[model samples]
Target: MRLPKLLLFIVLFCFVFLSGAQIQAQETNEKADAKQAEPPSSVKELKPVTTIDPLVPLDQLRIMVRPLTKDELQVEANAWFELLRNKSRQIAAARLGVKKTNEAIATNDDQQALDSLKKAESVQHMADEKARQTEEELTKQAQETLGVDVAVDAARPDPAKAEEGTTASTEEKSATTADSTSTPDNPTTTQSAEAMKAAFLQNINRLQDERTALSDRLEVVLTSLAAKGGDVETYRKYIAAVSGLELDTSDASAAWSGIKGWFVSKEGGQRMGWNLGKFLLILFLTWVVARIGSTVISWLLERKVRLTQLAENLISGTIRNVIYLVGFAVALTALEVDMTPVLAAIGATGLVVGLALQGTLSNFASGLMILINRPFDVGDVVTAGGVTGTVKQMNLVSTNFRTFDNQTIHVPNNSIWNGVITNITANKVRRVDLEFCIGYSDDFEQAEQIIRDVLADQELVLREPEAVVVTHALADSSVNIVCRPWAKTTDWWAVKTAVTREVKRRFDQAGISIPFPQQDIHVYSTDASKGNGKIETVSK
Candidate 1:
């Protein structure tokens, strides 16, 4: 009886505990629902945060939200406009931050300056990104709402337009509303859309200009901070970050924008112009110095050295070209152009050209050898490369020759150098050989004497080397007398022709017969009628 009474008491205690726990759980759920249904106490709490002061932490920068659907765009257009205005404000704040950083740097507050600069750079980047997002959203909205493709006309959104649109009076809003509610055929809606496109383009231009100005100012501050011996690595990171955020435009617009920015930004345009002017001045000075150097070298070569014309020209021209090349490199350096890539490209091009022009290169090398060896000079009569002519001109690849019969020939230097070269006018004197045929019956001594007299009468012939007149050969019908006369190289042709004409006239007057070849033929005929044929000779 005691155990049954105890079990009933425990069961009652368990039921009361379970009921109490259930009532408490219901009360807690009811309170939670009531709290969930309560509204915020202030309207300002509903607005997105837009305070991007220089003192604000970078992580707390505002994150702009773009509406993704047509209904959402309609509901959120005003909010987006406010966000765009916030972005513009952020840009302005970044500008202010840069100015403050500059001041801090001036005060030698390195840490503070670096922190401020970093914050400004971060804000600028965020603002730039938000501006791009706003532009994209505007394009999307235009396409979704008005069925107008602004991208087809290369119309882009302007960040400034957001501020302007947000600040517009109520009357403008009412007018825009009236235009939007009009029928599709109404010209006012079309006009509104067109005006919006123009505004977008104009705003984009303004935004780009403002970004350029801010970027330029920031660059100046960074430069000043670096000059002050601040933390370089930190500022360098800022520089890299800022560089990445530069506004990008279409190719045509970008070019035009750059030109406009160049003129608009005093530091950039003036600095570049100064650099360009210095580059040109240095180049001009280099050219002057190079010219003077070449002239001096030419004078020294002409007065102090006896070199071939080709060698002289080659040396002077090479020196001049090297000077010009160095000057050009220096000019490029003045303009802050990097030369490593230029030199690498030049070396690569030289190698490729060398490979493609093997035969031409062989000629060039041969020409250098010829210049060094002093084989021949301009105006010297040469017999080389299977041709005999006077050297007219020469270059690294080929030599020009004017033939005795008035024909121009271009001979590769390789051909001339690889073969035996005969320079007729290399020496002051040359020998002319002449052969005359006479009858064997005539006195050889008289013929020899006549030839000697002709050589003696020629004023151009040289007497120191003496002339030679000898019987060279005994032919079938005559004797061949050889005449060798030495003369100045310049008079070689004149002496030879005069001596030949004089010898012929003397021979005719001296009755020394010049022989001609003659032949006699004999034929025998037999009479067919005679049984014992007697051979008879017939002469005609």
Candidate 2:
């Protein structure tokens, strides 16, 4: 046993020495390769085309001072795309390295496996740096050739040049119309316009081609990365540059070096652990405080402040929710989650949601208005937004009401706010105004007295206001009487209904006539024998 242990120790020491030597040799070779493959000076060259000379004739300028050719732009774009391909290639190589590392581990070659992973990471880093420099080259080329920060196809044409073209065309048309014998036309202008159009189209096509190629390569790399999803150096090779090609990195969980990295990385492991501990402590504290805060709020509302149940619930719930959100934000920051981008994203998302849901936003605003104004409370019988119903539940977006038929109706707050709101039970007392028609011959005074008696006799009617019955109008067939009485708001409907029934009964009992609708037609006929007209009455 002593001899075997001694041999194992010697073997381990030799393996460690060999691995260090191998790593140092690999690094030297990589540096040499990097130095040899340095990018050409032309790649970094820039000749910024500041402002276009609108006065220069397109054809003349083509023959005179030299300008950058379209091929140069294509070469620059190709260079940039080549860098993208190389990046994908690096990731692919790293993936192979990961496989080799795994194989080494399965074969009990631990040092080889660790070395492989380290090499892969180093290669990925070098590749990323190269890609970054290449991106700079791409941007510089765009600035020099396009004379702007963005690509050529995205830039608008010069307004001055457009105006010049229009002016030239007008002059040409004027010349042709004035004289037919003049030089038919100069084809140079047509050539110039066509050339410009062709150039613009060519640039657009080239940009699209480059973008498509980059997108395809990015897709392939991403797909491979997804398939090889695990805690390996290969998976994270192209992680940082995924956004440029518009690939979503949210699902790149395995590339986070497993769950521990979801919070913080191993390089900052101690600090991360401390922060995580604090985060949990803060969360626990927040939860305890939130419960206490909610209880205190409810107690204040019920005992000290005095508010309705709904109002208290709304206030306490809102306060607790706000505290919860603030606590979560603090915890997230402690966990090393970037809050600035999170906040910006939230703001931008809010703007988009607001624009998309304009009607909904209006409803929310109106609900706030309704809450503040207190026009009508829940259970109030009201005519709102063209619907008459008893308000059941009033919320932020909509108000639910129960119609007379017991059917539920939901009204948007915006409509209710914009339209008229008539709360039937708004006042403590309400007046019931009713008009009754009596026949011309029957006895108007008696009918008025009967109406007053009916109103006064009603149980729900308020005696303090005193009921009034007056002759309103005397029509061709009847005398109209107005009966107005006051009652408690809750019993107004019942009193009005009862008064109507009682008035008709008392009038009939008192032999006072309530006339039905009638019309009298007069007919005139010519009598041939007497040669005179005779008139007769026809009642309807």
Candidate 3:
């Protein structure tokens, strides 16, 4: 009995000991999990935590009060919003972290609870901060777009929302009340739920008044500057800068300075010579590249591309322009030169020139259309603009023409495009037409046969289309016959001239008298007193 009892007691002791060990193992795992947990990469985790806020790049930055295009103003607004959002996040995270740290100590280093609370707290903080910043940005952008001080919806922070996050220990709650009196950077004047809203409204109103006064003054100053010439516009911009606006002050002076700055302002003028050398090198390279690109484009068009001559030329010209423009832009940027003013000047000059040469520009446009449409090309005999001439050269603005009288005429493209164009030499083959007249008494068949024989004998005339001599009409004294022959365009005139000469000669040899204008007349003589007249027909 004693042995059985001892065995049973040992079994019970082992079971209790194993169960306690299992419980201790579970507790250790829970502690490990708590320690392993960590916060995510938040806005605070960014580098250089204590440095000044990241402002927008100088090239992109614009004054808050300045006039800007829609796209530009949007970029500016987005930049400010980014900066503000980042700044607000960092502050909120820090404040919440402090609240968590003090609460963790109050809970006697309850690490597992603290970690869960931290995760919830940080997420909530980020969301709230984002919503707040977005509201502010929207309000500011609205006012800017309206170009006036529009009403802004106030940003009111709810205390219940901020403090309603994770539950804290009793000790943590007491501390929260004392710490919540302080804001992110400024202490709250009042403990109301809308304290933030009140403060923000007050600040915005002050800013609105200041900006309005400056804008009003600026308008008046600009009006005065418009009347006073000679760099008064430049002065106006500088004044705008003083009034907290960014006006583009890039003028001739700025342009020159920018150019000079490229060469002389690098490394305390250490690379002055090198910079100048680079400028010259870039120019030389640009010329070489432009020539090479032009040659390559021309070769491609000649061999591989199946476009028309005019299209080929246009493509080649455009490619070369691009090469030069790009190469120069790169070189200029390397030297730190700004081309804004130069480009502006060019645009302004072009506008003036275009307005002055309206007719010429019209001709140019019409000429381009003609070239594209290909109504007629060089060496074609075309009747255009009420003048018939052979095209000598077809230029972009006009067509050079050589008239039959050996006079050169330049017909503007406008006149030709608007007129009917007849291309006489467009066909490879042409018809030579000739007419002959013979006495009505002459055998019409014989006369026709004689003309056909003349045309058949002409070597320059074509035989496939066939030559024909047909009696055309019976006139008062003659039978009009037409002799038609076909010939190559180059041989048309020669064939016609030869056929005409031969026909006349053959008719004479055959005794077929060519008609001369003659009439058979009748003369009647009678004594009036006799009241009788004898009529006689006379041939004259």
What's the lDDT for all of these models? 0.63, 0.61, 0.58
Q: Which residue pairs collide in model 3, if any?
A: 522-538
Candidates 2 and 3, the one with greater TM-score: 2
Per-residue lDDT of 9-66 in model 1, one digit per residue for the tens? 9999999999999999999999998977664354222322211111122233212122
The CA lDDT at 86 in model 2 is 51
On a 0 to 100 scale, what is the lDDT of residue 491 in model 2? 89
Superposing every Cα of model 2 onto the true structure, what RMSD results?
32.9
For TM-score, the strongest prediction is: 1
* Candidate 1 residue spans exceeding 4 A from truth: 1-283, 302-306, 332-338, 348-353, 405-408, 441-443, 517-540
TM-score, candidate number 2: 0.46
What TM-score, over all chains together, does every model reach?
0.52, 0.46, 0.43
lDDT of 3 by residue, 1-540 (tens): 999999999999999999999999999999888766643344223221101112212322223324443333333334433433443343344334433433433343233333534453455455445644554554455445455553322473332233233223222433443455343322221222122222222222222232333333333333333333313344345434433211114333323433443334333243446667788899889989998998888888779975555556666777888888988887886675646568779898998999999999999899888867877766788999878999887655777899989999999989999989998888999988788899878898988888877777778889979877799888877889988889998888788788888887888899998877777787788979998888788655
Instruction: Give per-candidate clash totals.
Output: 1, 0, 1
